[model samples]
Target: MRLAGAIDIGGSSTKLGIVAEDGSIIRRDSVPTSLHGEPMVVVDAIVASLQPMLDAGGTEGKPVSGIGVSVAGFLNRDHSAMVHNANLPALHDFPLRQSLKERLGFDCRLEVDSNAAVVAEYQYGAGRGSARLLGVTMGTGLGGGVIIDGKLLRFTGECAGDLGHIIVDHKGRLCTCGARGCLEAMVNSASLSERAGGRAVREIITSAREGDQLAMTALAETGWWLGLGLASLSPIFSPDRIVVGGGIAAAGELILEATRASYRTHARPEFREKTQVVGSSFEGWEGIVGAASQFLNPIA
Candidate 1:
């Protein structure tokens, strides 16, 4: 069976895994991320964490054909390294692709996190049959990607040009990307935490699942802004399906119901009926799945 190694580097954590050709994950784990801007430290940690899995199946042959990396930022012109990301400043301009290959002794390729998320959904999750798919991942920051007729919408910088940076409210909040009222700033984990009394995002999602009123309210508010943001994006992509993934989406319907309501309220009539918003089947691990797909189910 063919296999691939994958890594998804985020603002708060790094996810690594082994994946098979049919889109099934063989191993999955995560490590804490640092904000101290030490690029090599992060890469070293990832290499160490992934070594065991790679060696576990080594007796058979090359354990994995190669590794794919997903990073949250604007990639360099040649898709070499992440050059910009407000949430993950440590890896900015870091030679992530080369470093991984050197340390792990395997081919490595970089993919924008947003692109990875959409590719995962399109290939093996909620977006399998979609003619047009738009996937959004809400975490330390917001990111999105698009697919049309099974091809990536890579118009600029390896993705849909920072969908999170779009302005949804001109006077709402300041974004890490230095913009005022960016959709991400308004609907990100920080804003959600603010509404939930400063609790961590995982805690808020857990509390909401346990029927905590305040937690529910916080997610609802975040979902509202998220819906507005999706509605704002509706006209451009006009997707048949919109898949929501990431930490915040763990609330499932608690967040999606509200997001759907707000989206319907704001979206045009034709779009309201045609577009179907759904949650990702991969939960928070879609990026890793897509990253692995670079080897398992490559899409240009």
Candidate 2:
């Protein structure tokens, strides 16, 4: 069976994996992202970590067809380089695809991390049959992707699906992107932690599960913001399904119930009954899976 090599580069760490056609990760590893070093240094580290897995495939007689990289940044129109990334300063305008291809001797494809994840959902997860799907990843910030008519939507400068910066409030919380009341500012993990009196999100989730009123309220508030954001998008996209992912989504109904309620309260009556919100099918590895799939079937 043919395989694909996948890399998901996040703010804190980078994940490397060899994936089968069915979205199963046959082998995986990770390394901390060296933000202060040159971009090539980080790429070299990833290659070192993945070398073993690549060699193992030789013995198994499964040659990797290509490598796909999912990056948490904006990609140039051609997708050969990262134009900007707040989390990894060293990677700004970096020629990621060329560097990887030179070092790994395989065709390499680069994609925005959120877009990759949404592709994973649309192709293999909860969004398998939806005509229009909106996938959201809630973590340090909100990231989004849209798939319509069985194709990924692309906009000017490749910025079509950046739903995080949508202004949800005019005079609400400040966002890292220098915007006021962005959906990301209102519903990110940092805001949730702040709502829980500076406790970690994990602690708040644990407390909420233990019947702590404050913790539950905090999650509910975040969900409210998330729902309002979804409501705002519903009229424009009219997505049939919205899949929420990332670490924070693990809270399940503690947060999702409030999200549903808020969406119902704010969405148009016509849309209210049509749209459905659900958690991700893949845990935290959707980006990796999607990256691998990109190699098998390149989206146009």
Candidate 3:
């Protein structure tokens, strides 16, 4: 069976896996994401973490045919390199595809993290059977991507998937991108924590589940903002399905209930009913599945 090595790089961690062309994850692991250091240092760390798995796979006669890397950053219009990112400072202007190829001596495909997430969902998760899917991941940060008729939508500098940067409040919280009231600024984990008076995101979810009124209220407010943002985006994309995932989504009904309520109140009635918002079944495996999926369906 043909195989591929897939790597998904996030702000805090990097998930690596060996996958079959059919999207099965044969093996998977993750390493801490190096944020403060030379670009090559982080690159070397990634190589070190995956070398053992790659070597083992080679000995098993399942040598990987290529490598696919998904990162949270902007890609040039040409999709040749990562342009910039707020969380991954070392990746700016970095030729990630070339660097990986040079180190591994194999073919490599690069993709934006959000784009990879959408592809994984559309092909294997809640987005299945939808002609148009919008994937939103709310975690340490908020990011999104669109898949139209099973095709990934990419644009110059990866601006298309920067839905988190959309301005929602004229005088809202400050964003890492140097903007105020951006979607991310309003609903990221950090923002949620702050809004909940310094409680961690995990704690908030726990408290809400246990019937803590304060935690539940805060989560609902955040979800309301998220729904409002999606309402603003709905007209532009007209997505048939919207899949929400990531850590914050663990709030479950606490968040989704508010989001659905806000959507009903703010969004156009015709469009609101047509677009179904649901949580992802991929859950904890989204990054792994997404990285692996890249090889099965390489960015084209």
Candidate 4:
């Protein structure tokens, strides 16, 4: 079986795996991102850790076809390097593909983290049959990816242009990105915690399920904001499907219910009728699967 090396670089950790041409993960492992050090240091660590897997798989003899990378940042048009990442300052503007190729001697393919998630969903998750798909991730911040006609749509770093940055309240919480009422700022983990009186999101979710008022309020508010953001995008993209993923999404129906209520209030009738919002299938392993798949099938 022809194999490929894939890596998903995140804010806290990195996942590495070998993928078969058919999108199966033959083997996988993970490592800390070590973002405090230079960009090259992290790159070197990744290469070294995965070298044994590649060697054991006899990649050198047949040549592992491509090295696919999924990272949380904007990507250059050529898709060769990470143009910018607000959370990962060390990786900003790093020639990721060049460095990996020089050190590992393999072809490299790079994609934004959300893009990778969308690809995974389209190919193996909730978006399988959807013609037009939108992938929304609610992590520390919101990120989005759109796929139309089984292909990715690249726009000036914003096919949906920082969908999380959508303004829901002109006079609301200030965002880390220097904006007020951004969808992310209004509904992310921090906001949820603050709204629940400094309670952790996990605690909030547990409490809400256990019928706690404070937790329920925080989740409802967060979901409402998320839905408002989705409602705004619905008109523009008219996506047939919207897949929600990330840690916050684990709140399940609590979040979706609130979002649905808000969406019904704002989205156009046609959009409301057409779009189907659901949770992701792979969940945390999304980036891992998508990163591996990139090497096997570069098109998506």
Candidate 5:
């Protein structure tokens, strides 16, 4: 089987895997991202974790063809390095593509994380067969991407414009981007944690699942903001399907049900009738899956 190496670097953790051409992740693992460490810290961790899998490819009759790296930031025009993201400062302007290629000895491609997520959904997961698709990821910050008729929308920052920065509440929270009431400000991990009395996202999800009212409330509030944001964004993209993924989406229906309800409540009548909001099947792994698609079925 044809294979590719995939790495997804987020603000909190880094996931790496070997993915088959059919989009099945053959092997997968994750490591904590050193947000405060130097750039090589991540590069080294990825090499140590993924090299063995890549090596075994040949013996397993699945020799890897290429490597794809997805970073949670804006990439340079060449897609060589992450250039802009307040949360992942360590990788800012770091030559991530070159560093990985030199150590791993494979052709490497870099992609914006949000773009990668949407690409994966379109190719293999929730967005399959949809002519117009929109994907949103929730974590340290919110992100979005768009795909239309099998082609990615690349008009903005290698993905859809910062869909998170759109103001959903002009009087809500202040965002890291120095804006007030940005959708991201209201719906990100930190915001959710604050709303849940300082519980981490994992803790909140677990608690909510076990019937914790406080935790459920936090997730509901976050989902409400997310749904409102999507509604505000729908008119611009008008996607047939919208997929929500990332760390926060692990709340599953706890959040998505609220999101679905709020989206319908606020979305324009035209969008309410047609746009579908659903959770990602990949959970939090969509980024790496899409990254691996660089070799399996390139998006750009």
Candidate 6:
């Protein structure tokens, strides 16, 4: 069986995996992303981590046919390089695809992380069978992607799914993007942590799971904001389903119920019953699985 090597580069960590054609991860590993270093430093580290997996043909004995990368940045028109990434400043304008090709000796595919994630969902997860799908991932920040009639939507800037920067509240909170009340600033991990009394998002989630009032309240508030953002976008896209994923989404219905409530309240009345908000099927590995699949069967 043929496989694809996958890499998902995020703000805090990078995930590396070898994936089979059916979206099963054959082997996986991760490394902390160096926030302050040359872009190639992190690249070298990823290459080192992936080398063994590539040579071994992975756990399923599948030879990798190519490589795919899901990155948290704006990809250029042809997806050859990262045009910009506020979280990983060092990678701005970096020729990531070329670099990886030279080091790994395989054809490489590159995609915005959120776009890759939605592709995974569309092909194998929650968005299956939907003609219009919108997928949102909330991690260190929020990301989104859209699929219309089974085709990935690509706009002029190639940033069509950058939902984090959408303004949810005009005077709400300061965002990393230097904006106030952006959806990301209102509902991202940082906001959750702050609401949970300086605790990490993971801790807050655990506390919420254990029925801690404060943690639950924080999650609810975050979900409210997230719903508002989704509601605002609903009229424009009218997605059949919206799948939410990320570390924070582990809170499950503690967050999703509130999001559904708010979306229903704010979205156009006609759209309220049309769209469904649910959790992702791939858990937190959607980006990796989707990236790998893009390498083997690319969307036209």
Tens digits of lDDT, candidate 5, 11-37: 899999999889999999999999978
**Residue-wise lDDT of candidate 4 within 5-122, one digit each (tens)?**
8888876668887877776777788787877579988898799888888787774475467788888778877877776656677887789888888887788888888888888888
Off by over 4 Å in 2: none
Off by over 4 Å in 1: 60-62
lDDT of 1 by residue, 158-227 (tens): 7898899899988989998888999999888899999999999999989999999999999999999999
1-300: candidate 2 lDDT, tens digit per residue: 668999988766788899888878899887988886888889889889987888888788888999889987788989998876555688898888999999888899988888888888888888889998998888767888888897887773364556888999999899878779999899988899999999977789899999999999999999999999999988878899999877678788899999999999999997799999988887767888889888776665
lDDT of each: 0.91, 0.85, 0.81, 0.80, 0.92, 0.87
Off by over 4 Å in 3: 159-161
Taking all chains together, the TM-score of candidate 6 against the true structure is 0.96
Tell me which residue pairs clash in candidate 4. 158-161
RMSD of each: 1.1, 2.0, 2.1, 3.0, 1.1, 1.6
Q: How would you encode candidate 3's per-residue C-alpha lDDT over 171-247 as one tens digit per residue?
A: 99999999899998899888889878899888999988899888888999999999999998899889999888877
- What's each prediction's TM-score? 0.98, 0.92, 0.91, 0.86, 0.97, 0.96
Local distance difference test, candidate 1: 0.91
Report the alpha-carbon TM-score of model 5 versus the true structure. Answer: 0.97
Best-matching candidate per lDDT:
5
Candidate 6: Cα lDDT at 30: 83
Q: After superposing candidate 5, which stretches have Cα over 4 Å from the reference?
A: none
lDDT for 133 in candidate 2 is 91
TM-score of 3: 0.91
Question: Pairing residues by index, what is the TM-score of model 2?
Answer: 0.92
Model 6 lDDT per residue over 8-81, tens place: 99887899899888888889998988876898998998999998999887454667989999998789988898
Q: How accurate is candidate 3 locally (lDDT)?
A: 0.81
Which scores better on lDDT, 1 or 2? 1
